[model samples]
Target: MAAKRDKRGLSQYRNEYLAAIAATFSLLATVAAAGWSSPAIPALKQDDSPVPITANQGSWIVSILSIGSLFGPIITGLAVDRYGPKRTLLLSVIPLAIGWVIIVFASNVHIIYAARFLHGISYGTAYSVTPIYLGEISSNAIRGSTGVLITVMAKFAFLLEYSIGPYVDFRSLAWISLTFPVIFFILFFWMPESPYYLLAHNRDKEALSTLRWLRRSDESSEQIEKEFTQMKALVQKTQHDESSLNNLFARSNRKSLGIILLLSCGMQLTGINAILGYAQTIFSKLEMELNAAELSIILASVQLIAVFIPTFFVDRAGRRPLLLLSTGGSLFALIACSVYFTFDAFDYPTETLSWVPFVSTLGFIVSFALGLATVPFAILSEIFPKSIKANANAVFAMVTSLVVFVVVKLFQVISDSAGTYVSFWIFSGCTACTGVLIHFFIPETRGKSFEEIQEIMTVESSSKEKTKCLPLLC
Candidate 1:
């Protein structure tokens, strides 16, 4: 009887873990497309390249993916709400596979541009959908672990691309990267739809059934029924609330949106994309003895290792502490890079400090993967009510893409004009300021259920109002 009562045990998470891993394959494909430019651009600029591209064209190839990111959210926002996350995610695979096919047969830079634009669309869609899907299916007990997989899978994909892209021809790399989307579609097609999505659509019976499967419990199980009842009530409440852009940004949700935007900006402006996009380029400029490709592999390997740290401790340590440590660590790493570049700019003897750039960069990647890379997405999945969750995610994802575009586009210009030290200084300042803001503003969501998290956001918003009134009262 005691064993029968243990329906919510760890064994219940087996299916949820499986489903989350399947969703990550889509993310793998998306990140591979984003990082492909890192390796493929160098090959394209080679004198004997098949599709010769100027440096200007190469930059467009990388940054235009962010342009595609801009439009992907709109499609995902519409499709995800109507068709549900599973189907919407399946549909996203079309553009990704098509994009890779175009790349495989590309005859010119313009064709590659179109292919990359499609890749960006998939990038935006995957980021918007995967977290929401994982969050909806997972119990609060393992939600952080599942949600952090998004970053872990993305880092793995980046590592895979950097490891493989340098050795293969551009077309061969395209052929290899295309397999991820195909595998995602195959694996994810059979997974159950989110119980929340099913309930929202008035498929309560199916919702109950999916909940049972996800929890590995029976229809007659008391714990499963109780859990299903709570989920149904939350879904019913959110489904009745009108969803619109105005409603999403209204006072009730304004705080969540603000937090998401801050996290998104901090994640991008601290130089993740710029570094990943230009790692080899930066290393080559320093005349590193290890060669650019070897250094890039090392950088990516470090990222793969660092990103795994969150999956183990996110739930145990909580989001706020990891995030605080991440920003603080990143602040120091960026300052180190800025200081080194400052010394180099002054033509000081830096022969002994050749390792600073690589070491600082590795430090930045580790700090980023530990929290900034993972926690934001986990918080994203927790904070929003179901009524506007998809809309909020789409908005957050779109803003993330736009910011990445600006950073990637300007990194080269800034480094060329004012020197790389200035770029690092700018990033360091941004990280410091963002960290302070996050410390004061962003609330922790570890171990919080969707309903509990909504209540916390509402309370926080109300407290903000009361604090504002206290000043006037005094």
Candidate 2:
């Protein structure tokens, strides 16, 4: 059974709505700062007439950012658990701002690489910390939507950079990116820390205060207290173990870890990043006549439109069904592209083959926005126990960055050597495998409470028998 919800009046819901908007804005600021730098990297590489930086060298610079981001989650997870989200977020802005400054002034490929690595750390920390903060502060009824809001905001950031990066100089784009971090630093000072974190650390009075501020009424006091007690109990249950990191892989946690890791990995294998990162090159190979700027605008518009589909239906339609639909849709799109490419390999006319790749790419993007892009973090946030949520999230982020790095790098080599059709086929195979895994292993989490989710995951039962377990803690 789902946990009972706190009854807030319409006025209170309004306040919560305002707070969610504020949190979304904060997230957008950080994401814009991190993502804007990426679109500029390709441009910087091609700025050879002015100054030479090979495309491969530019890619290396971008890859280093992912490497640096791999560390952000681990470091910020500990900090967020200890000092709270507000402070950790405040600290994150410094590196983001500095990294942009470095990128703006960088004279050579090596300097760009160093700048990206530094920015990666900021990106990593922000990704983990912001979601944790949002999850903690948001009402359960709106939690999934709140998580999607972050994804939506990040997509907007990506779109923003893609649309504008081509028009402006790389240095100017880097400067524009700096504005987000500056505003984040300024506004984050007023934002509240996660009340859940306070309770975890035994700061009960402060936790109550935060609840009051966030909830804006005494009506939820009982519910807030109940939640605090539950969090405290969970923390105590898990506190005795000194090995915080390894606890994620402990026997009891294995299923939870498995679900998170597989889902995280599946997210990358959907090939959304591969599509977005290489959209222009893919279009060029298809014999499309559009320039870089025109292609980027089209790509960005498609992504932006696709994001709205999930935003509207994610809550009502449920996670598992949407995931299945997304996987199947993406597979169809990829296979179509593969078939078209195969036809081209046999000397199909350019006029015939040109539109095939274009339509295939659009279908792939739409499918991804519907499925992999929307649900990975949503599922992750619900699956893990609060005690290990941060650490597990860090691990998830690290794995995602690693996969993206490998996929992006591999896509480049394979697309260059083997051709576009082979690349699409590879991604198609991955999506098919992910669909099979989801069908057999992934649980339906929509409309379920965190505690209900824990019980469902921990209990073992016969395939034909439904298991009814108590909430794991509280």
Candidate 3:
């Protein structure tokens, strides 16, 4: 009887996080989409490549995918709000699969451009939908884990490209990349729509069923009903709330918006895009002994290993602490890289110190992959009310897309004109300043309920009630 009861408990839908897992497969696919070029660029430059491309043309090809994604958030935001997360996610798969097919048959840069833009659309939809769906489906206990798992899958995708892309033909890589989305569609088809979305649409019966399915074993029907009622009430309340771009200009919303933009911009400003785009050139310039491909694979492997560190700490250590650590370490690493480049520029006898670039990059990746990469996202979801999230996310996505383009395009221009050290110095300063920004502006969200977090963000404490200055968090 005890064994039977345990078996029943284990079989409850709430006990399983299969839906979240399936949803993340789409994220996995997006990572593959983002990572595809890292290996393919070299292949395209080779004389034997099916379609040879120049560096100037290649920059557009690389950055244009981001350009496609620039419009994705608004489109994806509307789709999720209207059609719901599951169906919206399903929409993402079609474009990704089609993009791969286009890539497989590409004889020129134009076809590859078309394919990458399609992939960017898929990526944008996943970014908009997956976190929202995952947050809705998860128990509070599992939310941090799910977020960390996302980081893991993203790094895994990069590793997948590094590990496999070099050895395979471009057509073969397209075929392999194509399989991820097909697999995602198959796995996610059985998953239900987010219960919150169902309730907002007045599908109360469906929401209740999903709620019941998501909360089982120790949770009674009464408990499920109560939770469902609360969700319904929140959804209804938020429905009447304004989410205009004008709302983003309000004092409270501005603070939130500021944090969002800083996180988004800081993500790019820390120089990860530049590093990934020119890892070979950067390493080669430093006179590293290892082959470019070998160094890249090693660095990618290190990043894959390091990104998992957040999953263990996000809930326990809190968000701000990790962000501080990540940014602080990044500052130190960036400074180290800058010093190495400074030394190299003057033709210093640095044979013994050729490892500095490699070491600093590894440090930056490990630091970045941990709290800096995932915590902003986890906290971003928690900080906003359901009412403003859609608009806020669209803005966040646009800012992210715009910054990636500027920084990536500028990285090359800056390196050629001034020197790589100038960029690294700028990155070091940004990381240091972002760490300070997190200290003053960001809140610690761990151990707080969503309602509590909202209260922390919007409600000024009595100690400051008479003060005229509006603070981010009291």
Candidate 4:
């Protein structure tokens, strides 16, 4: 009986796990669009190139997606509040499919540009709304695990692009990618609307029913009702308080926004987007025996594997330690890459040191995947009050898109003018500054309920005690 009970307890989360997978599944295509340049750019620049592109055109192709993404969050923020995550996400698929169709038939650079912009819109909408949806649907007991799925799926998508794009022609690759969004829509259409959204709209009965379906199996009526009551009360309180743009500056919300922006900027400024977007081009500079495509696949695989570490341990080991450790490790890797580039820049013999850039990049990916990639995103869903959460995500997504655009657009120019060594050194300095900010400002939210996390944000910083290490970090 004891063993049977334990098995039943584990089975209760089956629907939650399935819904999270289906919702995030379309990320495979949108994210693949981001990294598609790694392989496609090289092909486009070839003498036999189907649709010839100059280096400047290639950079635009990569960066324009970010600019297009700026509109996505704005739409999602407005629509999610009025409509609901399920419907909003389903509607997002329209732009995504249209983008791919354009790409498949694209004959000119301008056509590809328009397609990428549409892809960016879909990417932004999915990212902006998915985290909020997952947070609302999941029980606090498993929220951390569910939240990390966003990054996990993203890394897997990057791997898919790196592995597949190299072997296929551009149009063929686009055709292959188009299938993912369809798969996501088919799987996710049947999934339930978020219970929190229902509660907020005063549809208490529907909210309760959805919660029961999500929590299926031997869960007692009283337990489900108790949970439903708590959710309703929290939603009611937040509705009464009612967040607005003006109140977004209230002490707690301002701090949360600051922390999110800092992490977002840090994640981009550290050059992850630039590196991934131009992985093949960056590796080509080394003149290695192995091709750039193989190296990119390896790097993406490392990132995919490293992301799983935080997925398992984030709720258990906590967020702060992993973040600090990831930052420290990334700093060390950036310094290593910078040193290699510096030697190469000075015309030193680097043939024997050919392995350095590849290895350092792998190290950076591993460290980045451990925390920077996953933690800040998870924190985005946790930190804000429910009233302001959608607005906050819009702000976060828009700012992040802007920062990524700047970094990716300039990386090629910076590398050409100042050399790769200069870019890596700048990244290291940014990483160091971000580490300092994170240490002092970012809070640990592991295992906490949304209410508890909000309470933590409300307290004055001066009033709380300092510790030698954040909880579990020591």
lDDT of each: 0.88, 0.73, 0.78, 0.86
Model 4, 344-449: lDDT tens per residue? 9999999989899899999999999888998887788888888888888888889899999998888888888999899899899999888887888788999898
Arrange candidates, best lDDT first: 1, 4, 3, 2
Flag regions of model 3 displaced more than 4 Å: 1-16, 218-222, 286-289, 459-474
Which pairs in model 2 have colliding backbones?
69-120
Q: Check candidate 4 and list the clashing pairs.
A: none
TM-score of candidate 2 to 2 decimals: 0.89
TM-score for each predicted model, relative to the true structure: 0.95, 0.89, 0.91, 0.95
Superior by lDDT: candidate 2 or candidate 4: 4
Model 3: per-residue Cα lDDT over 1-474, one tens digit each? 999996765466443367877888888888687777777887898888899998766666667677777767877667777888899888877888899999899989999999888887777777767777777777665577666666777788888877788889989998998889888889889988888889888898888887777766334577676677778888887788776667766655666777788788888889887787666657766556677777888988999899888887898888888988999888888999999888777777778897888999999999998788888777766667777776677777788888877877777778888988888888888888888877777778886756677676674445654263334322
Query: Which residue pairs in model 1 clash with each other?
Result: none
Decoy 3 TM-score against native: 0.91
Task: Arrange candidates by TM-score, descending.
Answer: 1, 4, 3, 2
CA displacement after TM-score superposition, residue 404 of candidate 1 (Å) = 0.3
lDDT of 2 by residue, 72-93 (tens): 8988777977888778877876
lDDT of 3 at 210: 75
